[model samples]
Target chain A: MRHSTFFWFFLPTGLAMLLFIAFPIVSVISQSVFTPHEAVFVESENCGPFGCTTETTIDQDATAALREAKPLGQFVGLQIYLDRGHLATSEVAAAWRSTDSMGAFFKTINNLPFYRAMGFTLTYTFTVTPLLIILGFAIAVAVNSLHRHLKGLVIFFSLLPMIVTPLIGSLILFWMVDSRGVLGNFLQWMADDPDLSLKASTGLTWIMLIVYGVWHSAPFAFVVFYAGLQTLPQDTLESSRIDGATRWQQIRYVVIPHIMPLVTFVALIQIMDNFRVLEPIIGFNAEAHARSLSWIILNDLNGETQLLSSAATTSVLTILGVSILLSPVLVRTWRDFNSKA
Target chain B: MASQLNKKPLALSLFSTGFIVIWLILAAFPFIWTLWGSFKVELDFFSKADWTNALTGARTTVEYGSPFTGAGYHGAWVQEEFWRSVINTAIVCFFTVTISLTLGTLGGYALSRSGFKYVFWLLIAALIFRAMPPITLVSGYLLQFFNWNVWGILPTTIIVLVAINQPFTLWMLHSFFQKIPKELDESAIVDGCTRFQAFRYVIIPVMWPGVITTGLFSFLLAYNDFAVTTLLLAEENRTMVPAIAAFMGTTQTEGNVMFAVAAVVSATAPLFVLVMFFQRQIVSGLTAGAVKG
Candidate 1:
């Protein structure tokens, strides 16, 4: 295709992405450095019955005018990034000096919003990715062994957990695991503890979210690996069987090696996804116990207080996290493209 | 492939079958259990007295004189006017899918046909954009949209979704376009046709299978979206997912959690139907990238 034709063809999508995706990223970074204007205050004198006092009252008109004049607000550079809500540089230093043990130091750091969210997001991403891969691969192999007709049925049911909206999926589980709900009741019976609520403990909340994450994503892995299984080389499998290789041995040697690329593909995509981990927090109402980076951004953007600057800062930090996770995938894609070319 | 040599030992076969059954239940039981529980009253649905009440709807029978009740659904769809949100969702999904596919097909085809290094960079840029959590983008949009006085409206959300949908759509369709023999379009170009005309006359005719698959995914993204819709929309303009989320906040405090349950089930019903019809396309679309890699 000629450059002119290509330009016309790509213009719409390119423009959409440039405006919405690229522009927003620039906007977020700029917003991170700038904050909403502070309320302009003026001192007023009140004199009544031989008593006089001066009061500092917010001048609404001036404040509104200032905000209206410069919507991006005053530029604070990296001030917001280092504040108590985010990086908390001074707070971390204080904790580092005061704590006598590593556990205490971590406990202090975990109280900071940014570190807390990062802790959960990274833990969730790392734990869920490997676990879901194993579960998905196991399901794929098991389904592959089933009768051909049963495969479709199994797949249809398997896709439900993933296909449903994340919030809705988590809400369903949350309701089931509420203290009085079926699963919660069963748990109390099994453990002989009537007061064992999953929501009350930080460790349990993390476990619940991770479990939900694995349930939500394993099907994606299963589908891809299942597709990989379809084109497996029968001759190699037959030879392995003739050599008296057990089922586990064949999978370890032939099947796993065949699907290794798919596994990598699933892992990279899941890592990018699991890093966000927003909806389940909202659904479970587990914000008090666990928060992800995306959730922090959402919380800042939500409700009576817009907190745009704070949210924008978290967003910039989250974008940094995403890029760090995405670098490996980008490098691999580059290598693949170069080889193909 | 299922011959004597491939036959599993009895214990192994039983274990695998058992595992499959356990996995299936894990995958599908929550929806089943939610659907069943949604018809009961809050007391029965979350019964402290007896867990079996949820299954049997014991308290539901005493209150409504029936084992099952539609009160939760009625409260959600009728009293709460969830139908408005449903209509909003329909409009959003319709426009998002149509516009996304139109722009995506053109861009994807161009990228596939071009030999320039810039095409590679564009795709890499798109992958980076795709990886960024959309909430980050929403924070960027909040300030701008509020400034432009365009927030909390259907068109604004639709355009944003279409934009967010572009990266994945372009990647998927680009790969799909690559599989279409280049000669198909080139032959048309040789016959006194402009590039656009070749695409319009020849390429469009044979692109439906790929387009449909891409369209299914685009629909799914728009439909299942919670992040963009919840943040971008006003209360009155909410979609089903956000509406159900809203229900949780209000109803949980009111002791009307059953309403949220019914709303969740109602929201999930269409997805169930969609999967029933489009399972094949969804699977193929999902594996398309992995296959290429």
Candidate 2:
């Protein structure tokens, strides 16, 4: 409890977080403002019988040496952030000027990589959070009413979707909805369209990803709400029932109010989780039809070039988005702490 | 809370039961279907000729002379050298969990016991860190690790995972430690034990349940991770998730998609067993933060 003891006890974890979490954030910010060095070129004059020509060749060795000297690349301030790959300020401005209507403007903006990803990420985050909450609450209520013996079985099965790796879960669903797979085949049969493919259309892909998101996260909500349900005030419930309240009325007046805090808790956590939304895109191979900020960063970081600067810029923008989403929660927590103290 | 008066109407009961059944099927059917499909050849698993071939393994019978086959598993585990990745994953998970819990317990204990405003700020900082996508941090790690020549290795990935695991681990364990009556440790100190001695003797023994729960989560984070491991590790040092991802990339065109399927099933088996045994701890761990809120 003393200062020195607390210091020693906290040092290891604090140091880990500082070095990895805090330091990397700083590194990402710096990297975002920097671009990789350009290849050095050497020009040579070739003498011929009647003509002379200048031939320029890349000096790979010098470029490699420069890269070696400064692995963080050349600092370009906020150039990368405004470039076509990321914020694309100029492109947005041009699109705004060119498009006559808001819908057309949005359509043009959607063609830009960053704004397109932002649109999907925000939509997925907002839609999935509330939907999963409703679905989770429904499951919690339904499972709560089941026989005690069935609770464990239902819960064990329920946790499977959430507990499995996100990539694998999405992959399983992806295969099932493949054109030749069971669900896809069944859909074709039901709709009487043998050529229908979920992956071919943007709307369907977005829906698929959203459904996957809800399915994957709903169990987490269910568990938390289920726990909140355990400590429900029987006295209040009985009193409400004695007042000739129906089941729905008892729930509306007694149950939902009691679990309101838990609902907020789940919402906050799910918003954070859903905002990332990376693996499912990869697993579903939905990148062609849909993309998220995390997925774009992943795509940028990958492949032959590594695109470090581009990825870092996207990373910074994504972090800003997360902070914007998190600010309200932080303010609420601070207020609660102040009131309690 | 289930009492005589709490009985639902027949229609309501039926509807709720039906809803639960639909949800359970939605939740469990994918894993079950995948597990069954992983044993068949690509054609039968994704049959266009007849959907029933997936269930009956008609093509599998025609080719391998059996309704089921382990060809995909063998192809993935042996031909593609997926076992190495599995071993790498095991090593990463082991170290990440052990080191994360070790650091987390100490820090969480300190934070819980110390009556200071700074403790609140530290947790808030951690909450922010926890919200930042791991992919963002990957770019940072890639730049620094490349500079340090520490990229593309299991140890580096393990340390990064342990660090990422710390925030949630600290938050969970801090809440857990708060629940342990402060008197337990204060009493130990009164008996002439040093703070370290009190922690080592009194707090450590009673901390296992919470620690175990936190460790389970740490293990899950390290195990299920794809972005960090894929980016931070070299081809030879890949973990199972990344390895399976690699399989998807290279094997999709070679009539080897089933190999990726098998690898996915293999990678998920451990988590399946983990949830089976630690369902309660996992649930409690998840709610620990919310309960405090």
Candidate 3:
């Protein structure tokens, strides 16, 4: 009876998810494999002296000619799969030549720029996640340690970045970092060099991106960690202090352990958010650098062929990478919830 | 007694005060710069030599003609573009918040109490949609709507914006709804109220804080959003962020005073009002729904 009731309750959500999310993903995967090249010519009789007809024909004539043409081939099954998905190197190479002019599937792995993008995205996620976590933890602890009256003020200030639009955040950074802008002017003054620009190179751009990310993201982390701190048992800390543990020692041994679950949870959240870091990086720089996965995906979609299949493949990879990276956190959360139950 | 009371931990107080001051500065510096920059006209902002040239003269004409001519700060209040952006942002935010709150609250309540076995997966789906880069969805929707010819029922830009923001509002409201106790629903049902009636009379009133927080965040998110709005919204319908971006992009020739002032005013105004009004709820909502819970 309970199972039936639960099923009834979940049915609408289940159907909606299947239709919108699951279907689109599956469609992308399937479309990546099934679609054939336009090389499968429809008309045999239109194969004129040189080859296929270069002239336009009536629909009736085209239909008749197509019927006269021998059926190009059968559904080659996994060969189509291999060719379309670009899984087989030789097939990929062959398909590349045919598709290059028409702007179709990737001809060569070198043509895709996937590897460089992946490296950049991984570096961005790994770098930003830890910085956000540590900075957030520090800010949270600092706020938590304040006299009760002052805690509100600190939290209110911290919430500013999170509440402001990321576009504005990036714009503010852009203005500050521009050649004639505030930071740039200060740098020029200090160095006595007028030509030094923040966006001079990929490395400098990545650094700027990281600084912007930390500024924008730290508030979120702080809020989460602060809340986690609030939930920590006061008795544990009081007892640790009574046992002659210093404040730092108490935080390290007791408070930190108590908040580990929350930390892990927030870390996973940060990883997901950071992996899709787009606005600040985009607002700051136009080109895709070794910065974010989403930026690479956007760049690919904007390319000549509009190679949505490749974009879809990259999206799937990102989703998988995030899931895999966060598996341990997920497992731990599950275990904790189950144990409590 | 007063002296004894005043003898609280001096080191802790000093440390905290220093920390607060540093954080306040860090948080306030960019805003302060933006505010100051907004007041100065274009020439003063872009001039290589004198950063304070705008403050010193009303319309200082320098001999740097060709590209750098006709640049100086003007009063921010008199700028027409600034007011246009503010009005456009207000309209966009107004619709985005109102629609998202109504739909999100309804959807959240349905999922929370509907006892559906698939509710977890539904929640996960919403999260995935929220987590996916907005560019992907916005690009897809843009292409889809560009080809659309459905008797002009909904404007293409509005549809795209609403779709992109829906997942976020849904996730937020879901979290809010999950936190509400289920017992209230059961008791209301036991009193012969229908499900919808119970939701209307019992669940919504209690979930007011969640709804308000979700609405405020959604409004801010919509107002500040640049990526989706930039791609999807037309120039005439451009929201504040994109308008500022356009201004920033064109600042080399047009100058920066107007853009800077506009950026500062637009970014800070709504945020200030919201933070001030809902300081307590905002703190609790962010920590509870986002971080801890």
Candidate 4:
């Protein structure tokens, strides 16, 4: 009777999940694999900036010959044009005729800047998540030690960045970093040199971007850690202190282990969020140095004739990559649930 | 007693105060700068050395010597664009918070008490949605909506903001609901209450903190959002962050002063009120989902 009641209760949520979330992802992955390359219609009527229009008709003989050579339904190739209604070369057309294999298609995408962007994203996520976790834990511990009245003030103030828009944060950073701004000027004075400029390309751009991200995200980490701290059984902690455990020892043995689940949670989220870091990139124009996976997806999607397939492929890759990396967390979560059940 | 002696209260208090002061200063630098920058005039804003210049500093006879030389508080406050941005933000926040809370609370309750065999799947879905970068979804939503042919479509700006905020709120609220015991629902039902009635009278009251925290965070999400608003919103409907971006993007030098002022006002005002009202709940809610049994 209990089993029947439980089954009836869960039916709606299960259906909703299958329909809304799982369906979109499955469809996206299927589209990535089975999607045929159709000729993109470069609409002549409203083409912006780039005014190139050309149609190359493949003759019956050419189609037959190309199909015989590649044994594919269609040829995948770039059609370059100098102007509206003009084809650049028949050679360009021939190249398209020969390239029909999935291997070539995948190779083309992998060779593009997308892979580099993915690398940057991975690095960003790995770097930021750990740093944010450590910083957050430290801040949370510090805040937890404060008196009741001052604790509120400390937490509220630390969380200020989480409230400000990332774009605004970038703007503030931009002003400060600009050669003429106060920060730049201060650095110049501190160096005792009038000629030193802070705006020039250096590793500093990446540093600044990371700093901005840390400032914005640490509040979230701090708040979560603070909450975790609150939930630690007071008796356990008091017992640890009674055993003559030092503060560091208590934190290491008692608090860290207790909060490991929360730390893992924060780490998982930070990985995803930092991997998709786009606003600060756009706002700061740090894209040249720091192109994250999301930036690559955006750039690909924004092509004159949208490369939805490529974008979809990249999105699938990201989802898969992140899932693989987070498998340990997922396994732990699953095991915990199974044990509980 | 001997062990307790080592945990000196005064030393701990001093240590905590020192640490907090440093953290607060680091965290509050951008906000304080925004506040200060908002008050300064254009020339004083851009003049590299003029950061130290007081509001009453020598008004040079040269035109554009100082932003304060010409504009007063009234003049600054009367800008049409500034006020419009505030209204636009409020509208966005109101809709975002309302929709998120309504759907999130219902969905969260369903997840908590429904004994749904697929509750794990729902939880995973919510996490995926929450985990996917806002930018990735924003790009897809933009392309899909830009070419949308449906008549009477809501503005892309509003839709994008709502979509970006929904996943986060849903995840947070779902966790909140899950934290509430199922026995509450069973007891309420045993007392002749319907599901909706129990939810309304019992669950919601107990879960108000979760709701408030989620709602307030949604408001902050909407208010702080820029990439979507900038990319999706048309010129007339742009929110405060995008407007600040525009002001920064433009050629005008004086606009930065205005941008800084607006930035401070827009980001701080709502957040201040939220933190004041729901500090405990907000802190607890943020951490609760992070570490679960």
Candidate 5:
């Protein structure tokens, strides 16, 4: 544990993070300010015999050379961030001034790409985090009451949703909700309207995405909470039971407090996760209805032009969003560490 | 607190039983239904005439003279070259899990034993790093990977994923290492062993269980990732998840969504097997944080 040994031991991972994780963050922040080179134009003249004419010609070779030499592009600070695709400060102001009512304002603001995406992202994050925690807790409690042999079988199936690839998981659900699929038929039958479709409504799309999020993640919470349940104090439960506490009362008073730390752990992780909700949006083909900050960045990154600057801007905004979302957990962890010390 | 008590609370038991049944159906039915649907002919699975045809394989029986056909799986795995992506995923997962575990084990041990103030802050920094949307970092990597000519290949993507997977692995391994008494290695050091030798001889032998648990998670991350692998990899170099996504994209135009259905079930089978085998390790790995946090 000496300084030299510690340095040597940590060097590889520290270097990896610095080069890949930490360094890219710095690079992304700077890249947001820079852009790819634009084509240069120059007047070209041609003379034949006696007459000469000039035309504005794009200097493609020069532009390619320039881009190759300094590929980071020109530095334009805060411009991209404030543009319509991102912060959209001017657009927001216009929407705010044009619309008098809160509903109207949101209607207009929702037309702006960033705000709309942000709205879905925030709603998805906040709604899914607590919902999954409650669902996971319920599953844990229910499974804990099951017979021992059934426990492994239930847990095995439970782990499937959590372990499967996010896109695959969502796609499986996505297909099921197709009008021709089983769930889709069942849904239409239940509603007594054959034309009823999940894909038509933005509200339904968002609900499906959130449901997928919960289905995919609740197992994580269940497994963690289930494990926590194993270490519960028998004495405390016995004492509570002897006091004529109902099962619900016992869970509310005794069981919950014991697993409160796990709850915090699951909540913190889920919020961080839900904030980066990108894959489900793509998998559900819900991008038209529910774009996330991560999806916006991917949108920019994947196209033919590889909108690096725009993607970088969105990346910066997303990092800021993640930091803001995670700030509470950071502060609590720090405070707890200091107190323990 | 399983159903161990002698006194039968019939109402609670009934409610729990109902909840379990509902949850099990919710959790397990989608895959089972999809699996069944994948085997039947396309129309029989997505029946227009009667919804019961899906159950009856009506068109499937008419076309193939049987209720099932491997045509979708055949189209995907052979015609679409889905196996290339499967192999690519295997390579990426194997290398990523191994590399990240190697780096994470050393780094985690250092953090746990060093007792330096910075160790705490390093982990804190890693926590922040771990939480950041990795796609945000992909923009940074895009220009660099292009400039360095490291883009669109398996090894570069593997190393990048290992780096992204590092923080969580390190945190998990660090917590797992903390549970072992420091004296395990310190005693070996006392018996004429250097620190490195003690770690190699004493600590590592005992670290396999934790590493294997951590390794399963790393494998999962590598296997399950879409953001990093999708962006960094080339068309031919795509992993299974992105390949499946691609299948969804083109299959609609091809009028062959069944290919995607077959691919989905194909992709899910390995994960199901993994869960059945490594359920205990997965659970332990998950709770390693809960117990400490």
Candidate 6:
């Protein structure tokens, strides 16, 4: 395409992304360094009817002027990042000094809001990624062997868990696992303990959330692997069969290798998806028990006060996390582009 | 190769069959259970008194004088005004998909056809943007929207979603356009059509499959979104997903748990029908990025 044509064609999207996506990111970075202004105060004396009385009064006009002068707030670079809600630099140091044992120190750090959410987010991402890969691979291989007519029906059903709204699906599972809900009731019966409740325990809530994550995402991996299976080389499979290799060996040697690239692709996307685990946290109403980094940002931004600075700090951290996760894919894409060049 | 294994070993066959059955049940049962339970009274569905009431619909039978009841749907749709959110979601999804598709197609086509090596960097930028969580951007938007006095409105939310959605749309459509022969554009241009004319007359007609696939995904993103919608939309202009979330914030005495249940099923039904109709496009759209990526 010529320069003029390309310019005209790409301008709209480029501008949209620049103004909305790119500029907001810049704004978030800046906002992280600044906070909202506080009301100004001064001492004054009023001696009209009563004895001279000294009092503190908010200088409303000055406060308004100050706000108008610097609406984004005072610059406080890295302070929000190091605060107890985030990196908790001083809090961790104090906790370390207070604790005589490593176990207590570790526990104290785990209780911090930012560290706690980051811990769960990391654990969920790593656990769900590999688990879904294996599960999706198994389902894809099993479905590939079915009668052609039945494949589509199975796929249609398989997609339901993933295609449903994340909150809605998690709620469906949440209620089922609620104490009064069906599965919860059945579990209580099976355990011989009527007091069993997933909501009351942190471990139980985390388990249910992870299970929901796997259930909701595995179909995506399955469909991708299923597509990859069609492109598998028949000649190699025939050769393996002629060599008297068992089905297990065939899949181990032939099938796995055939879909290795697809596995990487799926893993990349899953990491990106899993790193932003917010909806499930809300869906389960497990904010008391579990929170993610995305949840932290939402928590800060959500309420009547609109804690913009705190939310911006979390956003910066969350973006940093995404960048670290994305670095591997970045390297590969760069290498691929170079090779093509 | 497996078919040639003269007698399919009983253990292997049973294992595969069992796995398939278990997976199907695991995937389908939650929705089915919820759908069935949504139609019943709270006691019968949750069954605090007797677990069997859930299976038997005992309370639902006594209350509604039928095995199934539409009370949940009525409460959610009419009493709670969930219909407003549903309509808002429709408007948002329709506009997001259409506008994003328009901008994405033009941009993607340009990227694919252009010979500049910087196109690689442009796409790489888009890839990074695509990986960003929508919530991360919401903080910045909140302040900006407030300053502009446009926060908590449908149009502003819609435009933001379209912007957030643009990167993925461009990535998918770029790859989609790349697969088309560039000769089509060249031929059209040679025949006296302008570049835009060639894109309109030649490329678009050939690109419906990919466009539809991308559009379906855009619609899903707009529909499934919780973060931006919840934050950016006002209380009065909430969409379905966020509205459902808001239902939980109400006082527990309202007996609106059933309303959420009904909304869940109601929201899910359209997706069920969507998959029924567009399973092929969906399957293809999902894998389209993978093989190419």
Candidate 1 lDDT, tens digit per residue, A266-326? Answer: 9999999999999999999999999999998888888688888899899999999999888
Best by DockQ: 1
Docking class of 5: medium
Largest lDDT belongs to which candidate?
Answer: 1
C-alpha TM-scores of all predictions = 0.97, 0.97, 0.78, 0.78, 0.97, 0.98
Model 6 lDDT tens row, A1-341 = 88888989999999999999999999999999987788999998888786899899899999999999998788888998999888999999999999999999989999999999999999999999999999999999999988899999999999999999999999899989999988898899999999999899999888889999999999999999999999999889888888988878999999999899999999999999999999999989999999999998998888778888899999999999999999988999999988988
Q: Give the better candidate number (2 or 4) by DockQ.
A: 2
The worst-scoring run of ten residues by lDDT in candidate 5 chain A lies at A67-76
DockQ of each: 0.86, 0.81, 0.31, 0.39, 0.77, 0.85
Relative to the true structure, how large is the alpha-carbon lDDT of every model? 0.94, 0.93, 0.64, 0.64, 0.91, 0.92
- Find the 10 residues in a row with the least total lDDT in model 2 chain B: B1-10
Q: Assess candidate 4 and give its lDDT.
A: 0.64
The per-residue C-alpha lDDT of model 3 at residue B152 equals 18
Candidate 6 ranges with C-alpha deviation above 4 Å: A47-52
**How high is the DockQ of candidate 5?**
0.77
Give the alpha carbon lDDT tens digit for every residue of A1-341 in model 3.
Answer: 14454454334444444444455556544434432233323433566578776544356654555544632222234443243333355655676666755445533443445544555667778888888888888888778767788777777777777777776777777777778776878778888888988788778788888877777888878887787887788777777767777667888998889888777767767787777777777678645445455665666565566555555555666666667776675566457655865
Candidate 4, residues A94-193, lDDT tens digits: the string is 4356669766644444334655576567767787788888888889998876678877778778877776667766766666666666676777788897
lDDT of 2 at B116: 88
Q: After superposition, which runs of candidate 2 have C-alpha atoms over 4 Å from their true positions?
A: A58-72
Model 4, B1-293: lDDT tens digits are: 64454365777768877877888988887667655555556544445665565233332224446434334333333553556666777787787677657766776666666554577766765666666555444434433354464211324455555555655666787778777888887799889987777778988779877788788777777787755665556667766776666655552465535544455455566676777777777776676566653
Indicate the residue-level lDDT of B289 in model 3. 52
Runs in model 1 with CA error above 4 Å?
A44-69
